[model samples]
Target: MNTSILFQNVKLGPFELKNRIVLPPLTRSRSTQPGNIPNDLMATYYGQRSGAGFMVTEGTQIEPRGQGYAWTPGIYSPEQIAGWKKVTETVHKEGGVIFAQLWHVGRVSHTTLQPGGGAPVAPSAIQAKAVKVFIETGPGQGTLADPSVPRELTTAEVKELVQLYAQAARNALEAGFDGVEIHCANGYLVNQFISAHSNKRTDEYGGSLANRLRFLREIVEAVSAVVGNDRLGVRFAPLFESTTEERVYLGLVEEDPHQTYISAIKILEEVGIAYLSLAEADWENAPDLPEMFRKAVREAFSGRILYAGKYTVEKGVRMVELGYADLIAFGRPFIANPDLPQRIANNWPLNQVDPSSMYGGTEKGYIDYPRYAG
Candidate 1:
């Protein structure tokens, strides 16, 4: 049988993926309560989708202070590590490679999600606009609330956050993950530092583009130190333009996204990380990353590159054929079809994802997604 590019083996740094299809980081918020630890349900969910070439766990908080949404898993505590052990073991048994996405919401968090009811932390003291954080109001019920005004992190505190990221990498290793991916996109803490509109600090962590990239550089360095550069990955959401108000969620579009991302990928090149994950706008009519930006990414980074954002099988194969993207991640499709890669390969029908069960839910939409019968 002729193999599709999506099912072909590809080298990503020191590791070689069995295929080119990836299950991108997705927030299901199904972790156990009290500690927001991964549970059996979460493990089953990941295990069922182990057919993908690689899988990245949902945005996991590096520390308690890193949390912004209720019920999302964390990598800090011992219990959380134990919980993730079950998940990683199951996926590994199925011959799956998985990475943990270390995340911090920064100013995009509400006081309820903060420790001791404190404000969220950011490079500058600014309130995020047009974003809502989910808070658990009761069992099986959550509501979105406006984020609190964040306080600027002091220089010492910024260094501490770097340590936190490194520690999370260690925890990821303990939890049995093959690697770790730094969440530097989607208006999160790292994104805040990268954006001129969000980072208004006068310190070394802000100002020029180099200064703005300092935080990301520090975190990447620290994390790479723990997980090894060859096992480290970075994710960035570079939007060129927003056709409507939804574009505001990620932050102001960079004047030259090509140059901005090329420079960022250059940092990854120097760091010698495994791969770079670029998340494009997923909304309807959203533009794909420009051809120039795609070439710039390939030229700047020597390692593999993964792209996600409403990707279809044909588009993914086209990107791979064009040498633009090494791997393609399917998000919503994987949510409803645990056997997405196999389904695509055999031309089988896919299950439709229920948007209502996306955020926080039980076994219904979490692990009950049936595999292809054919």
Candidate 2:
């Protein structure tokens, strides 16, 4: 099969990517402790994978309360900003384009990860079920625990969160990132507000579909003011009932995912953002997105669309050829093979990812992944 389409340049917002392959945001939990700051080790990891046309950093929390997992980096502090600067600089040196993924976990967090051990905040007072959050137990030690029951965010606080997202975008730009992608997917803060099951608010920020999307619309506009719309992207994981129970834990399966997400995509389209990324179910035996839904998304949104999750070269090429996706992100494959694009180009054998060292560790499974020897 012809894989050349994956190597062709494509326009994304104001920038033109070298290829259509993307390095999607994958949480490695390797940030430096005490402040969750990015470090040189992380810089090395990204630099090694700079061959991709586009790359997004691991989900970097916009504020302290936004963290649900231990040791994930943040974009809220000056020191943290400087740390990320090193990462962006490294990628730039290799002539790679990178974007910082601004994130907030909402109620999918334990109290230990919150400010003053306070309850995690959400659109409503609901505890996330069937999910475990990673928390630091000690220096270089951590364990997964149940998410704490969350308190409802006041109307005023919801507006404040919008400004926080804008500030995070400013931070990302200051750190020399090419752009920023908002983590609005996978049961994170933004997704919590969008999911009807998680958001039971009666305020203008919830209830109706438009109201539920109000938070997202405001955030996209707010962040776009700081970083132009051409440099802003949003990610969404629209889960359906077809997903297995275990895989659906990250984001609640919506009753009408197609209608819900199409409405959300329309909002992004209205704002004229650079791109929209949709993360599909990645588990073995997981189903592909419905053809009807993909077609609907293409008709609803005019900007570039990205799809990630278990995409092989052939599948990615087909999606690009079919015009369903403008880019394909390879997550775990890029994790184990830093020269992933080259491997795909050359048909080289790939190194299997070491699952044990996937997160919060020394640079064993990270930068140590060697390129093909042949």
Query: In TM-score terms, which candidate is top?
Result: 2
Tens digit of lDDT per residue, candidate 1, span 254-358?
767677778888999999999999998888878777898788888888888999999988888888888989999999999999988889888898899999889
lDDT of the candidates, in the order given:
0.89, 0.93
Residue 372, model 1: lDDT of 76
The candidate maximizing lDDT is 2
> How close is each model in CA RMSD to the real structure?
1.4, 0.9
lDDT of 2 by residue, 1-374 (tens): 88888999999988889999999999999999889999999999999999999999999999999999999999999999999999999999999999999999999999999999999999999999878899999998999899999999999999999999999999999999999999989888999899898999999998998999999999999999999999999999877654445435464788899999999999999999999999988888777889999999999999999999889889999999999999999999999999999999888898999999988999888889888888
Q: List candidate 1 stretches off by more than 4 Å.
A: 1-3
Show where candidate 2 strays beyond 4 Å: 246-251
RMSD of 1: 1.4
Give all TM-scores, in the order shown. Answer: 0.97, 0.99
